[model samples]
Target chain A: MAHVVGPEVVKYACTCGLLKSISSLYFCRYCCQLRCGFCVCHEVDSHFCGKCCENLPSSEARLKKNRCGNCYICPSCQQELSTRIGSKGPSNPEDPKSTPKKMYYLSCLYCRWSSRDVGIPDQSAATGGWPDRENVNANRLQEIIEMYKAMVLAEKQQKEKDKKKQRGKYLSYTDRTGVTAAALRKRIGLPVDIQHSLLKAKPKEPEPAIAKEDVEDLPEELLTKPVNLTEVTTIEQRLLQIDLQPTTVEKLFPVHKQLSIKRSLRCRSCEHNVSKPEYNPNSVKFKIQLFAYYHVPEIRIVTVEPLRAGRPSELIIKFTNPTQHQTTITILSLVLSGDENEVKEETGDQPSLPQEKQPPSLSSQPSSLLSLSSRQPSITIKPRPVSQEVNADVAIPSSKVILPPRDDAAEYDDSGDTHNIQDDPKLVVWRKSNKAFVKLLVTPKQGLALNTEIVAGFTMQHIYTNTIATTVENREPDKHDHNIRVFLTLGNLVGFD
Target chain B: MSRNSIKILQGALVCEESKLRGDITIGTGTIIHPSATILAEAGPIIIGDCCLIEEQVKIIHRLPFDQQDKENTPVLIIGSHNVFEVDCHVEAPKIGNYNVFESKSFVGNKVTVTNGCIIGAGCKVTQEQILKENVIIYGHDCHMREGLDRPGLQTLQMETLSKMLPNYHHIRKPNKKN
Candidate 1:
């Protein structure tokens, strides 16, 4: 038995107890709060067109330019954009009566401003975006040279420290041949006596250039003889430590992360929001209303066939929408039997059936019936009136409100069988929809327990929004451990369960 | 530890909780005060071993907030055998080895001071950031705690060390001072 309560009897409590709602309610999953629209603050970081929203990688979204390659910008203003809303306001800034089209806008790299202020009538804005533009600064080359020089100096200091030597001296052939006495003395800051000693020890001589004919003539006899030049060389070749010059100090800059924003729905009246205005979760429009009084529902298992040699069999469900309006119902997934577990093990040893060789049209599943038309036509059984069995078979009024399947529902399959429905073994059915009647009859697979969640009294939107709120509430740290066992029983579908 | 043998180089004041790992090169007469920490969490800290480290120089090596769990642990390893004068703070959880920390210098958290890095005295490095392979940083001469917590407004006076130091593995012209 149930009792009806007045609106005053219901205390105003948000999904999270931080706030109260008298008339309407809404829930935010990210923040885990039930905030009134007026209380929440919205911030838009980066505005992007529809194409980038669908194609661009998340890493690329953080860049200053939102447009990808194979797109061009507006020729007049050199801005990348896409035309979205059209013909909404006044045309000219000065003229009062002229009508205007609310057009798309893009940012300018040079000016750091958008091109929406000056109406450019960009035809390419509909199909094009920014392309690769050349950088004009020429001084960038000079800066790079200075950077390379500094790197060389740091490496030399590290080598000396690693060797653990007190007075290690290293030199190259370039240093011995190219360095002049005066320049070497000035660079190393050696004393005048040492500088003179270095010059005196070196032999001042340049080899004479021989003509091509002379080399050809002398090569036969003179090339065979080894000439001893050690006696003519007065100074011994010595290695000196090269004094590395330290680079000038340069400033560093801090790094920041970039964020991107997307718009789903726009308002026609005031462009203040420019995107989807979130609705109150408790409103009637937001709710899922079920009208079950007019139609009859049936679940027909059209086909059942074996897949692997000894594994669990595949079952196909053919649900017919006999009513005039299209019926939307939820399939609470399928379950397998314990007895079939032995058969599943033997099938694993054998190689999987080659599914790719089949034709494209028949590639979905080999076990299930082709479509609803291929199965038997609608068989309408006479409705049973007033009986205890009828009351038990059909669930009472106001049971469940179904919402559109969430996006992350695909992660429900831990195995890669999310797309293939033949993998499941057990199937559950709902007895009633929003307090509407439900009837189930003979089917091949039986002995399954059905959990009929009878939702007392709530709008369609409230139930769906509450379902989302409940999921977020369980994700809190303290409740997460307890929820994990419940979530595992429901499988990988984290959002709904 | 002879009084006349060790020289006091450049470094900042540090805390007592500091831990030093790997091969560290400290300049003569550098002072390392109490409470400053250093963890050669990664490879080694190869200071020129001759440079001075001042007192209270906090040099630490710990991972940054974003890359902590994803990447390897902080390694404060130095190789530049620089001097540590009195009151120098040095903390590098992950030091690669061979980097030099001047007196009165401060470094904390996953700061990879690779070989050949020269940190000036009185310099404070906070925020789990990267100092790359070969980089040079000059400390602000005035105060040790100026502009420490201002987000996005921090002025980091750093330059590419490659421009000043030679590539450790490459065959190129060495620094004139070496």
Candidate 2:
């Protein structure tokens, strides 16, 4: 969360080979891998009007062309228009007791544009009854769609008739009688046209569009009249109408407000939702959010000395364990080539190794059968090699740094250190509840020009405790070390002091 | 040049907490709310009938930069049925009938507001220009557009405030007799 303000100094490599901050990555529990936005599948969960907060179903939204029915935006400024009431004076001047009639018109309170400005009459009712323009070519388009539907239906029926002819080859009762089905039907006193009547009527083919050689020439008035920019509509304004793109400002009409959508992300491999928002557009809460910041430890750069070419610089980085379990951190050398070997092993060994390792009794258990039937087979995508260039070498520390579990009560208590834990004083500079600062020595590569950005890389291996119980017998938490490649962009090299 | 002169005609209701200074004349059937200020720095201010000035409104009549040294000073006259909404600041030299200065609106001294004009809420009009009849200035960008009809009067709101304000606050007595 500290990286939300400034430039990204620390980046973690996702399983899909994209480098991103911890706040932007999602950790999938089923796959046990970090997923980025590029690798996950995104789907629109709901469509809602941003102004009215009214949610619309997908089918109804499609019917309205994905625009709100009641809301409208100003054609000039694109702001929401409010309906205002205008009172008309008495129609009969001699009638003293007559009351004024109220009429409503859509007006933009922001831009002061009203429906009356475009010569539109006011409406008696508030909601709806506004004039809606239809496309001039709508009838032609409808004819084309109906023609295509009929053509497809005719093609399908012809294919079925061909299949029926092929099936009648082995059954030769008609051939033995030296008569076809139509002749046998006639001899049996049934109607010869019964088959045609039984099938549905076939539609006639529609006329195709005709291309004419004569094109309309440019208007003669363009040569005499001076162009006014305000009267002519811009490209953006014309595109807003989409179907009827008016070129003049007077022809512009109020546009229906477009609907916004809420999206949900799913892990591609396991098909589990990584993030799913609530159905209600007003509710800001999420049903399931597997953010990597909640599952993995976060790393941030605390301080770094001025980096010079080929000179060693002291860099202090802070690591916070966000989990409830005590974790151990071990620093390893950055390996750019080892990822290819690991990917080869994963694809080559996964299929045969699972079948040979399971015992007969273990596979026959009722719980195992239940789990096997419920779980879908995962399709693991091949991991790409890390593409970071390490221009500086980091001295990997040998001792592992241990971080205590986070405590809610320890934050309030002002008492000094109570737990006695041994630590490597040289490597660990400072320690607090669930957080530790580690010291590292980085040496930039020599022969680099001045002002070149120095970027260092490393491998962070941390022990993760999986508390999820996959089987009835194994209730204990599984402790395993997970590795993530981290890269830090140290500031540009300064002149030698 | 008396600095604290205020003239309230018959049937005008001016709250005691309202700050008035320098040759200001309020017409009949006008209502001035508490904490509203009217200052005539270089000239006199004559407000017409049936006007409603709400709380925290400031109306100042100061001379322009070119006309500061003239012996004959022009008076800032605001016509009848005009509503000055809450927290508006009006420094316009002239405002005609049926004009509305909406809440938190600022009208600089350089602009002249004509009849049936509306300066919308939170609109700041500082450019030196003249607003034509029935012109509406609104939005964050100060967009100007011609309106078809003038805004309605707030007689009901004026009646309610006039009845309620006299009970709890002091009032300035009318000086002009009929």
Candidate 3:
């Protein structure tokens, strides 16, 4: 099962108009809509070292520039470097009783790059104490960043002063108090004007970089000497040391391994988490996973006859109800124009889905009001029209096929079929506990060239039972007919037989 | 040609599990780990002193195709203090002292390794060329660079393995005294 590759024969349309397979789509239970990766918001959940699997906090990771402290990568090949011990001979060759001293150096097992290759001295201990090189222009860059931050703060303060002056024209606080702020400051024996003093003590500005007209010429050796490509570093090697892109291979230094991140996805409209991974980096379990495969009806291509141009082909697709509730599947015609209108209406009706807050009851306590006031309004994204085009026509089935609820025990008890339910012989070819194979006649459009790819689309309407208990008095589950657009890529068209 | 053809000099440790074939002369103070293969297909192989050959290392001395018909079979001489790391395939015609062949590094018979050279792990040197002294071959592209100093010797590991291997595995008796 792990080796089985999925052939993208069926695709479901996402709410954001992106077509994706069911395995890639997520069903947001709060919004009760399908969301693809494009429509969801992704956030980094954790930062971890890929080599050691040590989880680092975001603050510590940021301080270390998002690199593992203990792990070092090869300067030449960027592979992980292992610590190797080298034994040095005794100081005096005549002293046969003396033991050799052990020295450790970082070495890459893959690329054979060792600290000794670049003239780096070996350390007495194994784990750390390797010297780290500081960027040459770090102090200059830090000063520039500080200067920009002060300048932006000064501009923001000026904007606020202008706004205050504008508001003062309507009603001045000095006029209402019958005294100016200067008088109050004078009475308190403080500085009369605070703005002037504060402005005079502004942060020092950094010197701007000046571009010179005269550029340095190329070295004399470059014109005379034959270039050795092996001695020069490639562009990729230079970029590995971002600060100083060394052109020569001698300047290469071991880089700290960068930390990896785990991501969590959230539905944009409902502000609900669609997928949230566990905090532990080693654990692959997720806290919340609302995949479409667990909520929507999965459709797989069973068999399809050879599609000929302008000829009808028998396309059999198996549909399985993944939800616990029994559902009735209705196959509707591919109404492109009608779907556009329905999407527009749903976008317009999204605001009305959230129920209005009821008036405060007479017996309500003050704490309840605090909770109600803290609730934030959910943001909804406008739905877009699906962009898929149907090239082949599907003959809609008149009768609706009903699927039973999934039962785990029924899989083990594979005795002769019981609880018989009559099904349409022409529509449903086979039926099991919760799976049904339906047959459809698909006709390729005429005038299509030979070997042209044929695509057929249909609207699948299934009964969805929302098990969420609302504030209403009734405890009954809310059942509504949900419609989804499904597209099937039939085989290429064949020439006339 | 025969099991007795292996010539182990004095103080050399040759494990019984090591596969030695044809006329092979192991120098003094050398340590041959178990499972290391030293095959002399066309001629004799003379390995120098203080060399460490680890497990799964293959050192084959086969004549080149163009030189196979020559009446004189040149001896493949590996210099002193050369280290053959685990799982490395070395078929170079000549190797100098203080050269380290890292794990899984393949040195074809067409190449010649000089003194103080280090072959990066998994590097394949098939181009017919001679590597200069203190030349280091590293990275995916087999980038070459000259080292400032020679790599440190594995004297401690050799000493430990020499004492430990003789206790667990059968050792070939040295054919010549020091």
Candidate 4:
């Protein structure tokens, strides 16, 4: 429940200043920075129908205007319409053995809306041949489109002719209109101007559309008859047919369900996909998942004492190491003012690579860049300073807490403590496999009002083990101290009786 | 509350363990589970034919607050083909034919239920309103939708329950001969 529907008491500050739960954040291994949905580039991976789960190619999806061809939704209720079979009387009633012909029609189970209500004929076959509504002004619209195409082509040819004129060593009079060149040739006693029979004729141009002042009068029956709301279409029902927007229920028709797309999120800075789903829609698996819950240490508030003004309260927080490698966590004072950051300092100190946040060093940079050449260059959003105000001051412990790597076998075993390790009695309250509960003292700001919300923040530095080999010689994983600012909403302050 | 008077008609299958109070009449082809409770507080509860009263179902025949002072005893008449699912509480004044009270649902005394209505699972409806035929009350918000046809009857489920129930538990013999 805490992983899904639990209240977000602990929030980790993302690179974009927004505080999000660790479950929603992505940890980019290359940049070693936490990225949220706001600071990532989302690209569509595939398009598929939600109902049929039939995957459509990008080109085919574009041709169908991103709507599923086979499946349709009810115009009234916006639910998927199922094909129901209707029995029609056999034409050959004289024969006793003939079975009744079956016809298929669309019907909505929830609302009991049938296609016959809108005068749609039942189809003999199931899949295709449903009549598409022809636009009333199709011919006129076609003429207008043709006229614009010709006009644009004519303008392009004229521009090319002007460029040729600039390159001419000797200017000719015929270049002005072509009539001047032909008339000049006729005046010079040239035999009737030999002409190329295959020359194209002048492009056709249609008349411009004119606005009409006349409007259709309202129907007389609307004023006389009592209107039934159910008979009239609702706003949502009308909006389903974006182009038509039919007002009457009679005009409503079944709409093809819109296609859903599977999107892959890429880290804005390093151009690496943080999360990518499997190609099949049915598979609930991911190809690459860099969720912060999996990579970073998950901090959960176990319990906190009653908060009072200027009083030190005991706060116990449990930290779970989800990664395969063991890491040490040190509680640091949160630097709310972004004047100095630990990430920038770590990059500056490294003598091998001077570039900051660019982890694809000499070994793995070239191939990744080549594959992403077709995609647009992702814009690097600037990191914003953490905005959460720490109203309560936390007593930072000098001692670092070490957590064991996650083990699947240890989770099932209910036996007593197998690995005995020395822990600081003052800070570490409890310890188990890959998890440790640490104690901290928190004091609300002095002269705080009664029942004021107390928010406390602290910077946690954990050594992150990068398993990705940056060089050929690097067989052992390189560990770097990654800093994450976590804020806890420790409820409202209470008054001392 | 009066002394228990349960009248089981012909072809009715009622478990002996069921709690029946104050002049309750169960009609033909009805199946009553062992743990169902039917309380007739102010009047007699006349349940019609082919009604399924599952376990933990409470059917109370108590009058509403406004109508409680009146001396006239209103007979709570449940029409034919009604289903009272497990853990549902029904105190409706009138229930027409082919109505389904789903599991854990509560139908207050003020709501008048007509024919072919379905009160969805876990839905609590207390407001005074008449439910029309083929009306379905569903979801957390109790959204209403009018279905074109009545919800299909649970004939197959009732048949299975009737055959399987007699094997496991003691059934009350139908007392009414005619």
Q: lDDT for each of the candidates?
A: 0.31, 0.80, 0.80, 0.82
Q: Which one wins on TM-score? A: 4
The predicted structure with the larger DockQ, 1 or 3, is 3
Misplaced by over 4 Å in model 2 are A1-10, A51-54, A83-104, A146-232, A301-317, A336-338, A341-349, A352-395, A407-420, A426-431, A437-457, A488-497, B1-178
Tens-digit lDDT string for candidate 4 (A1-497): 34572589899998777899888899988778788999888877778899999877665575578999999998877889999888888746898678888889998765557787788999998874677787677778767766665666666678987775345322321123233334556568664312321133445556777899998899899999998554677787888987788987788888999999888888766567899888787876999999998999999899999999999999999999999999999999987866245334222333344343346442464655665443323464556778787899999998999999999889788995576678889999999999999999999999999999999999999999888877777787878888888999999999997
TM-score of chain B of 3: 0.96
> For this target, which candidate reaches the highest DockQ against the unseen true structure?
3
Which 10-residue window of candidate 1 chain A scores lowest in summed lDDT? A480-489
Per-residue C-alpha lDDT of model 1 across residues A1-497, encoded as one tens digit per residue: 01221222222223222222222333332222233333333333223333333333323442334444433333212233333443446767689877774555343322122333233343334443423233343245334433444444445456767886464222222233334454466578975332333433233333433567444354564578775331121111110100211121111110111223432221111111222322221222312212111122222333433222212333333333323332344432121121132122112211232332111222222444545233221221121211111101111223322222232433464453222222111332321212212222212222222342111111111211112222323542211000000000110111112
Question: Model 2, A1-497: lDDT tens per residue?
Answer: 54472478788888777788888899876555678898787777877798888877665565578899989998877888888988877756689778777789998876567898788889988885889988998888767766666666677678987775333212322123244444566678785433333344665455777999999998988888887554676676788887888888777778899998887888765566889888788998899998888778889899999998888999999999888899999999988765653364334333333342222223344655665532332445577777877789898998999988777777888895576779898799998888899999999999888898898999888877766666767777767667788889887888897
Which candidate wins on lDDT? 4
Which sections of candidate 3 miss by over 4 Å? A1-7, A87-102, A155-203, A335-382, A403-421, A430-434, A469-477, B1-178
Worst 10 residues of 4 chain A by lDDT: A169-178
**What ordering of candidates by lDDT runs from best to worst?**
4, 2, 3, 1
On a 0 to 1 DockQ scale, where is model 2? 0.30
Candidates 1 onward: DockQ, in order: 0.01, 0.30, 0.34, 0.20
Over B1-178, each residue of candidate 3 has an lDDT whose tens digit, in order, gives 4453888899999998999998899999999999999998878999999999999999999877998999987899999999999999999999999999998999999999999999987889989999988888876667786666667799999988987888899988899876
Candidate 4's docking class is incorrect
lDDT of model 2 at position A370:
61
